[model samples]
Target: MLVDDAVALVPSIPGRRALLGLAGAPAAGKSTLARRLVAGVNDRLGAGTAAYVPMDGFHLSNAQLDRLRLRDRKGAPETFDVDGYVALLGRLRSERTRPVYAPDFDRRLDEPVAAGLVVPAGTALVVTEGNYLADDGPGWGQVRDLLDELWYVETPRRLRERRLLRRHVRGGRTEAEARAFIASSERLNARRVELTRPFCTRVVSPRDP
Candidate 1:
């Protein structure tokens, strides 16, 4: 769907603070699309009308992952604080009388920084992007339930993989290390995310923007 069309869909949802979720596999352009949607909404509606909240912020710290022995599967579904994410979403929905702060993931630091984004008290829409929003595993189902709508961002496998490799290399991985990580971790996560496509309200291409 066209991003302008997607932007129009946000305010139409019946709520004081509607949450719009953009879910997809890694490097499928969920983050890009979410930023566009939020910017488009705010430009069309008004400043402070929209905000962005990213799910990457919920990723477990490397130390925590090491303790759990899931460091190797860092991007997997089990590597996030799902319950915390769900609780934050609940607050973003009900507590509209004050600004709500949300965390953000820093790729360079490989850690989640608290209160990196803020949703104003009277904001009309919150655009959140992530890989596992549509996943039904454990605490993930509540994420889908909280959002008024969840749209899957679809990109060709080749393009997605290329982007992932570039992202990893930019984050300090060698080309060989990037490819290995993709093969061992990202590929499996992407496949798992694909299974949740049926749960999305819409499937949108990154090219649509």
Candidate 2:
């Protein structure tokens, strides 16, 4: 189904901001889909009517990872600052008149860029995508409650793996390293992410109808 179609269904709250979340496994294309939904809604509504805030911005810095001995598995849920992300989302919903800044993850540097994205005061919808948005753990369950709607982007395993391989290679991994990562960390994380599917408001596959 077209992402634009999904955007059409987002009901506007009278005074509070509406939040739409897209959750999926690594390389499942959640971010790309989230952007499309945001653009589609804005196109039909009005410019500056929607904004995109990604959870990747909450990724722990390499320094922090090194200190925590989690450098080897940087993308794992434990590697992120969930509390910080949750707080930001809370602020976005409560502080409607002020600007809320969100961080963006830089793949080239494998780090987060501070205040890379801004959700303006009048934004009607905020589209946030990430692997753990629907996670049911203590620090994560709040995410599901904050979102007005959550769509889980599901991709075929093979296709998802291929996209991940390419992304890893582009991010400076060799073919062998990429394959090893997929076989180990990424695969494990993907499995965990899929378990949160039942918590989503809807499942959005490439073949969504």
Q: Which candidate gets the maximum TM-score versus the true structure?
A: 1
The pairs that clash in candidate 2 are: 1-208
- What's the lDDT of the predicted structure labeled candidate 1? 0.88
The residue-by-residue lDDT of candidate 2 on 99-153, one tens digit each, is: 8988999999999999998988888788888999999876998898888788889
Encode model 1's per-residue lDDT on 109-167: one tens digit a residue. 98999898888888878888899999999989889889989999999999999999999
TM-score of each: 0.95, 0.94
lDDT of each: 0.88, 0.87
Error of 1 at 168 (Å): 0.9
Where's the lowest-lDDT run of ten residues in candidate 2? 1-10
How displaced is residue 207 in candidate 1, in Å? 1.6
Model 2 spans > 4 angstroms off: 1-14, 206-209
